[model samples]
Target chain A: MKPENQTISPNQLFYLVSVFLLGSSVIFLPGAQAGSSAWLAVGLGALEGLIFLAIYNALVRQHPGKNLIEMNELVFGSFLGKVVSWLYLLFFLFVSAMLLRTFASFFAIIMTSTPLMVFLITPLVVSSFAVRSGLEVLARYSQIVLMTLVLLFCLESILLAQDMDPSNLLPFMDIPISEMLLAIQNVAAIPFGEAIVFLIFINLVSAPLEAGRFMRRSFLFSGILLVLYAVRTIAVLGTHSTISTYPAFAAVRIINIGEVFTRLEILLAVVFLSLGFVKGSVFYYGAVLGFSQLLKMRSHTPLILPIGALLLNISTLLFDEYIYDIIDANMLFPLYSMVFAFFLPLLTLIVAKIQKRRIQKGE
Target chain B: MLNVFLVIIAYILVGLFEAPGLIRNKYWRELSIVAVLLSSSLTLSLLLAMGVRLPMIIPVIYRAFVPLLTWLGIM
Candidate 1:
């Protein structure tokens, strides 16, 4: 069902979802909330993600080859569907900008000598190249990146093992229920809610039904990786993980493998940057593709730059600085994202279901 | 300021880089969108370069959505 010459295999789709889900959340999530119970929150969050993905899957399964944009029109009238589609596109662009802002700020903080714009522009530029090359290329490229990420993630955990004290994970589940729920919601919203964007890719797969199987598989794998990483952060950094801005990174910095592996934090940075790039590219492509379809344009190529520039500008103005950005993405993004991920889609599903029953009764 | 100079140069280079193919294909809508978006980005970039502080959108959104969040009991 992918555009002419653009079909991706279920295997490719599996890895694509894996890398996309792991993107930024894999880095900042351990430090988000729930204290020493943060890893528990991650586990619960993965379950929550499956629930959200279930909703997404149902929406896509209802209609065989149509993407979300098309489904809205099919469910609602053209006028209302177009509005819903437009909202999703705006959400995509906004998320792209936010992710870009996150990575750019990290670069600025780490390499203080370099100008911030360099950090902002470099990834956008690289991601634009991926977006412009088309979906098949992007899928192949992401598969390679995910392999490197998995390898590096394992190596980093192994190197940081000695520093971890099992006592760190003790005295857990002490956080209040509300705080735990908030942590779960943050994980649900930040990584899994963003999976809503993949609805835009429904038609890009060879078999949309096969998407559900691979999506579930990908979600399980991503969930395990996230949980493992969160535990590693807790074990290594202890309760200190709750307070620091970047506990995983800080823990990685203390990776002193017999005085030889001290500089391995750079590998962690590379992991974050590469994953962020994959995440941003998916969002960028979603926005461009959706916009072109809305406008009835034959090609989405022209949009790759203007929208990139628009997003880059928006990234700079997203928040005053990094910590504020983090606070907003963690605290505020969930409530904002739920509309697109949950409420709006649920509305579409209910309305579509009723309409189907009516037609069946008429028959 | 060097920041201002570098930004304006960036605007020009992007134009030089993307404009020709758009023109060759005679993509008027694409060309216009690129023009508008580039101009918007360039204008904002220039303002920031000149030591002007840009107000962020997050606080406004946070304000607007506070009521709903309170209702949901998540805030």
Candidate 2:
């Protein structure tokens, strides 16, 4: 089946976006550099993220029925467009590889005995299958995953309520405004602004025009979840949340309600992994679909496993230690991500608008 | 050795599963692309299994950004 023929509902789009947004960031806690003010950073970051989302949505609206790859071709002409598209394809693949690495590292920490490749291959294989099945299947799967994660997260949060120290969140925003701004930038760059990938899927929605609305709703939902997640980490782990690599998991690890709910970090792991799967699948599918479309291939199925293997290899090479991933997230990723997430999309939208005016004048 | 063998077998299985469908459809271009990607990935995976260290661009990129971030006082 041609991927273009597959369509998912707006609700499915919402679920997929929410799941993808929460993916690794939920466990990794994107704005931990802000210390006790991590939640505030995320809150401000969501506002900035909305601006990025609006740019992506405007670009999609400008080029309805066309993915970011196709829009590049139409806006920039064949040669330059192909170059831009290739860069974007690489960006998508790189993001997928990063997500895959994050997933593997998370599991590697908890399941210390399991080989890292096993964790990496598991999600890669599953995502390859989902990508080959087409976008509808992936979206439907995300719908189920997002619902389960929400229910479990709520249950876990209520169970950990007694463990939350309100004072941990006190003296908030005490950090230098510059550090706070950097943390906000970090949150905006990751999890939120990374929704630029959704531009690829916007064309896949049955209601393409309404895709932006659904995306906004998903952002609101995930933004709230992200703030709650940051607050939870700060409340539960307090100062340790700033230093803990996996703050969400560490917070949940302290859940010892009469020792009955001890080791609930396992539960958080399950939720994070599920979100990771959806996140990985979206990026994987976007990269493959974009590649096939860029090549003018009739189908993306044949490309799935081959690209998956490359992705697995790339993921392995991404970070030797988990600490590098954290450093990259804190220091480099925000700036590095901006080129693709903000600059390129903004450039595309402006050129598309200019071209549209020229065409209208010619008519 | 076993890890390398398993990596090879995994690549072979993936090839067998995907190549036949492309050949059946006579999707020559698609088949070629798949062959190129699969072979390259196989080589990379084999090297990885053999404990070879491949050069990574991420660190370089991270390094390149360090001065900019530090100058801005974000680092």
Candidate 3:
């Protein structure tokens, strides 16, 4: 069992949430489904993300100091709470698998020499090691690595300036309303919906109210970066945004700084690997903790390696080909994720409200 | 095959890494979870080593969900 003494301050929580939000989404760029309207979709996605964070923040405020699991237990009582908690764990497990697969599959497209397992297994093992060290280690690791990531992104964007033409973002907001709405649905589930895992970490905030503050800031910071990235990618890739498998990589690959420095895309490997590491480690830790909590175990470390291995296997075998999962994600995942993102939290909030009223009536 | 051998060695190393604490602490549930994990990993690894085509999760999930998904207007 991790001691309660392992509390991280709101400041650290802010960096952690920012890095977590920036994690896998940057590499994948889910808003490209909106075409030239991708930049607009990303902006709207940020607005939606703020709403999502507001719900999470409100939930945290209503039941200060209690994490998502404890909140479930309080709202639903022990037996049902554990069931809901188990479902959260299952969601964590599958989502971790989904992300691992996404990253690995992206690399598989780039390099064919390595067998698929080689890519899938490395991050899972590395993340298990990180999870075993506890949250303080993750927080410190993110603080340092996130600085490097930001610096690298700034450098890459500067180098790519010649290739990016703003005119490529023309015909903006021209997509059909239904298509834009669909893109929004898809965008919401990604990056932000994946953040449903944050519920596990928010309870560890020293002052529970500060958790909300840190998270809202993280949302905005990550939101701005994502929106800029989508616009930049669309500006460079133009009509290719709809077809480019890894648009960010494609956009970055063409950077030529006075003909002396080309293929700067190599540095992007850092972005992909590091951000994926942070994202994977977060979800992996969440799954391990949630699983142990579901089992009523006080310590999660003992289960880390096994769960990590299971995650590797599941993620490696997640799809026959990458595109099927991509399509499913765009199609069904929005609906699937809403069960967690909207319904579950909303249910908990409503039920908690009713219980509080009953208690006040008694008092 | 060399790959199968390496896979076995990896499982053994994982066992070596985990066994002592589990025994010292009498962590039966963890020991079981490790056992299941190692066995599954080895099974998949050995199959890959032998060049057997592995069945994927999507077909089953797609088959089962097509009706429900279609019904929900999400297919």
Q: Of the candidates shown, which would achieve the greatest DockQ relative to the real structure?
A: 2
Give candidate 2 misplaced runs (Cα > 4 Å): A1-4
| True contacts recovered per prediction | 0.64, 0.73, 0.44
Question: 1 or 3: which has the higher DockQ?
Answer: 1
Model 3, stretches more than 4 Å misplaced? A1-5, B1-5, B29-55, B63-75
DockQ of the candidate models in sequence: 0.59, 0.75, 0.48
Q: lDDT per residue, candidate 1, A273-308, as tens digits?
A: 878788999999999899878887656777778788
Clashes of each: 0, 0, 0
**Cand. 1 TM to true fold:** 0.94
Candidate number of the best TM-score:
2
- Give the alpha carbon lDDT tens digit for every residue of A248-308 in model 3: 8888888887788888776777777887788888889888877776676546776787777
Clashing residue pairs in candidate 2 (N, C-alpha, C atoms within 3 angstroms): none
Restricted to chain B, the TM-score per model reads 0.80, 0.90, 0.70
**Model 1: CAPRI class:** medium
What are the RMSDs of all candidates, in order? 2.3, 1.5, 2.4
lDDT of 3 by residue, B1-75 (tens): 887787778778878887787778777876776687678867876786677788777566677667767775554
User: Model 3's lDDT to the true fold?
Assistant: 0.80
TM-score of chain A of 1: 0.97
Q: Could you tell me how far off, in angstroms, the CA of residue A247 lies in candidate 3 after the best superposition? A: 0.4
